[model samples]
Target: MKNIKIKYATTFTIVVLMFANVSAQNKSELLLQSKISGVIKKMALEEKIAMLHGNALFSSGGVKRLNIPELTSDDGPLGVREEIKRFDWNSANWTTDSATFLPNGSAIAATWNPEMANKYGVVLGQEANARKKIVMLSPAFNICRMPLCGRTYEYYSEDPFLNAQLAVQSVKGIQSQHVAACIKHFAANNQEIDRGEINALIDQRALREIYLPAFKAAVQKGSAYTIMSAYNKVNGYWCSENDFLLNQVLKKEWGFKGIVMSDWGGTHHTAEAANNGLDIEMGSSGPYDQWYFAKPLLEAVKAGKVSEKMIDDKVRRILWVMYHTSMSTGHPAGSIATEAHGKAAYDIASESIVLLKNEGNLLPLKTDKIKSIAVIGDNAIRTFASGGYGAGVKARYEVTALAGIKARFGKTADIRFAQGYKANYKASNSDEQNAGYDKPDRVLIADAVALAKTADVAILCIGSNREYESEGHDRKSLELPFGEQALVNAVTAVNTNTIIVIMAGAPYDLNEIKKSCHAIVWSWFNGSEAGNALADMLAGDINPSGRLPFTFPATLHDSPAFALNTYPGKERTTEYKEGILVGYRWYDTKKIDPLYCFGYGLSYTRFTYSGISTDRKTYKTGDKIDVMFKVKNDGKIQGKETVQLYVSKVKSSVSRPEKELKAFKKVLIAPTKTATIRISINVNDLAYFSEKQNKWIVEPGDYKILAASSSKDIRQVAEIKVMR
Candidate 1:
């Protein structure tokens, strides 16, 4: 009795301390709010209005009298963009502005590691600070709705769960450095075609399950300080002025405290945007004061079209963000393009190179035996640090594939290169923009074939570049552009020891290559150290561990959007006909096999799965399901494996996907060693958003937990019952 009483007393003391901490935090927040209110009251209507609009290309106005600094921003889904002229898109010509270019979004997602995402964010945030900027417009994580979405490289994965995981960590990582991470493209904004005008009509359930989770997680869990409204419309309403999305969903429902800024020239009306939830207007055209949120907003307030209270609220939010960023205490002095930042880029790029195929044990090239290496294809010499559309980094330096190879193999083997095909792509308004690009050059092919014939091994570097897989326009098809197919055929015919390395950001038609090529590697528009990372992987300095973030369809017609004829829709509007069944969900449920399934990647080593078990057979709401399994490395080298956990509901009353990803972990294991792994999932996460009830509902039923290497590679399964 005495012991039990002491335990109860101890629990009570801990609870009291927790409540006290919460109370103190609440007091601090209230104080901050009071201070913000004081500042807003002293500001004139014109000053308050100015705070809501751009004073420069990448910055908003601030009251100099009040000592408030303008909130500066930088374009950052890949890395901090080069400093541009204050009034135009021209470069500022600052030699010190070069930064370390981190891997793109899809490449980061390919690792399927949230920890890596956090590291990516830290690099971005630190660089933003180094540039003396407050906001980093980054970590764009729109769902990969289609393989040819143009910005697929800039986005994350097809799975909402994966996107949410990465988004949360990315946000936390960025904000940790006292720089705000502006998670972007607020709603759908999935396609680049007619992006500013097209309306996306999506059902509530689909929005909840497939589209909105990442943004929601970034706001509530990651505590992101800013969000950027997309250029497109969601359900007939422009995202910048959408009452339901910006006001109802983001601010009220999810309790987001950040400011909502518009995409470049994305604002439409002054009153509508101000009355809605938009806090800042950026990238709009015309005079700085004439922008929608500038002089127009002040006039709107004066005319009683938009309330003064709304303007004050917008200013308050802006100041709140400022206090957290530029005005924050003890902010770290950040460094840019440092050696450590370069290593971070290298680490992400190294883990991101996915090995698609390694037939005949041809990888981990026998460096000791090779005398000469023939590196072919334009990608070998191409620099991806800058070019194309959207955001491009002014990389301090970018190591090309050929450069990386020579650095790694110069002492061991003789290396030669031939530009197998011309990129031939230049962003323009002419007819040649997307035309006359794929035809292979016979002369270049002949040179490549001759080099391959004389070399002991040939590395054929081929695939899309920044210009081909850019942001302004989607690819017409998935075929290898720039006559790459013809180049591959010509080179491989002469050299049977050819290894194909695909340097691209999105999926392409690889059906032909999969059959013809004995080895294949998928590399992205990786950042500064792209070549170094690729060289290290090829030389077995580090094993390839990246998995496909989206399913690679066998054909364009096989994808859900194309199969249902709903993509790019009709009459300036598109319906999400595929609904919640996206990516692997669609393929798995429809029983269509993808060229490469989501979470699929190959390694030089092999792993075996066994001993799957759960802590309990029954779960209730709020319960955590603990899953345990064993993975044994069965190869001669060390490697990392991503363990994927998927859940399926048996005999559901409502329609559901075949299975949904619930949890995943990336584990590194030494050769011939066994490692026990445990992952836990919250029961609340299994709940589905019910449109009829307008709430999440967890149905009582039998759930099958599948442990797998990839979506289609289930290794073990355990059954559990959920009780209401």
Candidate 2:
């Protein structure tokens, strides 16, 4: 009798789950049939209004009920965003803290390997779910509007393919934990000038090809639960209320089964946003939501301007998402923890940092007599400086280089400190912009130089700060702050053992510093345990394994589209004349030299790639080509290798990049050990977005597939023919 009862219960559970799975497949079926919809219909106007106002509420360890409605959210993709921000009780229902100080998205994009990105998402998800957050408002896909754009750090890259691939893979990882990922800043929101009002008047060709691909890709492939519309207008209509953007392209063509949430302060009018499928007004509580969510939305319904069906659809989508996340896979919500999260962040961030330049055999520092170490730059001590402004810089802990050194070598070692340059630039809140701090103090560099003369090694930490780079404003130039270059020049002159570390969101000009500094590390704003990670790399505790996420141009002027001027600016037009030639592809195709190539990073260990062979010499429309290469460690220490594969179209309608990165992998090998890697490529990898063709066209031709350690360093070569 006991066994029979247990068997019946198991059968009932399976049938229920099966029913739920089938119910989820049909979006409309769930909208009409789910009990959540009926409850929504029975709700008073105020109760129904509450569902559309997405307020920031904290619940960790388990679920919390709200008399209003409970919606969850998190920070950027590199990690779970901090949710301690306070909300403006007046206008926006969303959190006003607006500062979760997460690492920039471009930094993740540089890693190239999707698995690494997905790993980042999973870790972020673990934290979000543990905190009872239902949405991760990140995987920012904005274009790198300019080399200097402040928010460039928030975006993936200038290249659409890399951005789309990284965003999609990351979303899959986050959703794996039952949390929703929002692929954001919908449609041509590249610039910061008049961001709340400027129109992005892009032609359809550039819009569809360059700006829209990533958004489309994420919606089409990834498990994106929501999309936050931008503040700016696309063409003529604001993104939050754009009909074609919300309905035609997103819903009809791409079939994004997600809510359209408005960016903080992005809602202009409640009715306009709602009619366009803008489901929730985040952060706003005033005219749009507080009043709108309460009066106007229901008023529209009663007036037949909107319907019970429409309101029911919106509420059902919200409740269904809640239910799905509450019981994701085996674990329900609230399983994430803070333990090991900081450590895991350190590991991933340590791997993400790329060694841009290592010269004179100065790195992997020999520590016998190198006692006196001069640590320069204000950033050496500004722990939270590595992350952005929103969510307010936080971690259970931070690993500063100074702490790393003390932990590794103990306090007995001689380590002198100096602020190479002061980060005191405080521009006014608005463009009358002349207020708090004037410029970076040059006298600080002179003081650091004097200290450097007494030390055997000079560790200079210099780069842009949160003030100069974040979500709202864009950067103006690629150059470092005032006197930093001169500071770098002075420090390296006194101590040739100088290693310059640039801790920033976007890439900066380092030509002068490279000439004098024996070694250089480009550390993107790493989080929490960033210091320990940097210290480990500096002390040779771990091998340096980071690659450039975006192309490092010799000069900002050298960029192909530089002449296009201020993008999405007050002028309302930012032409993409370079078309699809972005990142290394543009530099390679045009035969121009980048200061540092994309997919470029240095490791303490040496890796040799050889024995290039393929499963076949030819391919058709849907065939996959397996290209294999053997990588051997030639260095004394066991280390990892990032094998990058480039697929070149020997001939094309338009000239191609000298070669394009089709696929890559970061493989680990033991000292003197050999590891084999095989990467598969599809037809999509070989096609180009032709403006005239208006389609991704693949020409019949011979293609050269090359395997290399870096973009410029080709190790082995193979060939295949495409027969149309």
Which window of 10 residues has the lowest lDDT sum in candidate 1? 426-435
List ranges where model 1 is wrong by over 4 Å. Answer: 1-22
Q: Please give, for residues 1-724, the per-residue lDDT of candidate 1 as tens digits.
A: 9999999999999977866777777867878999999998899998888888888889998999999989999899888899999988899999999999889899999989999899999999999999998999998998999888989989999999999999999999999999999998898989998898989999999999999999999999999999999988888899999999999999999999879999989999989988888999888355888888888887888889999888888988999999999989999899899999999999999999999999998898989999999999999999887777868999999999999999999899999999999999875545455577778899999999999999999999999888877788888788999999999889889988899999888899999899999999998999999999999998999899999999999999889889989888899999998889889999999999999999999999999999999999999999999999999999999999999999999998889999999999999999999999999999999999999999999999999999999999999999999998
Task: Assess the local accuracy of residue 278 in candidate 1 as a C-alpha lDDT between 0 and 100.
Answer: 92
Q: Under the 3 Å rule for N, CA and C atoms, how many clashes does model 2 have? A: 27
TM-score (C-alpha) between model 2 and the true structure: 0.86
TM-score of 1: 0.97
lDDT of each: 0.92, 0.72
Candidate 2: where is the Cα deviation over 4 Å? 1-49, 54-68, 77-103, 203-205, 270-272, 284-294, 302-308, 326-337, 385-389, 427-442, 566-570, 654-658, 689-696
What TM-score do all the candidates reach, one by one? Answer: 0.97, 0.86
Tens digit of per-residue lDDT, candidate 2, span 1-724: 9999999999999977867777555755454456565556566655666677654432211112333236766555545544454444222323422222234576677666677567667767767766666788878888775677667766887777678888888888888888888888897777775778787776565676568888988888885888989888887888988988998888778877677877876777766777777777775333334545446777777888777667766766676666556534475454333556555566667787778778877777777757778889887887653333443333445667676766765554688789877676543355344343335566786789899999888888888766667656666667787568878878777788888888887878877776666799977777766777787888787888777777778898777657445353446545556655666767887788888877788989899888999999888877889988899999989887888888888866666667877777888899999998988989666876666756777777799999988778899999899888
What is the model-wide C-alpha lDDT for candidate 2?
Answer: 0.72
What are the clash counts of all predictions, listed in order?
1, 27
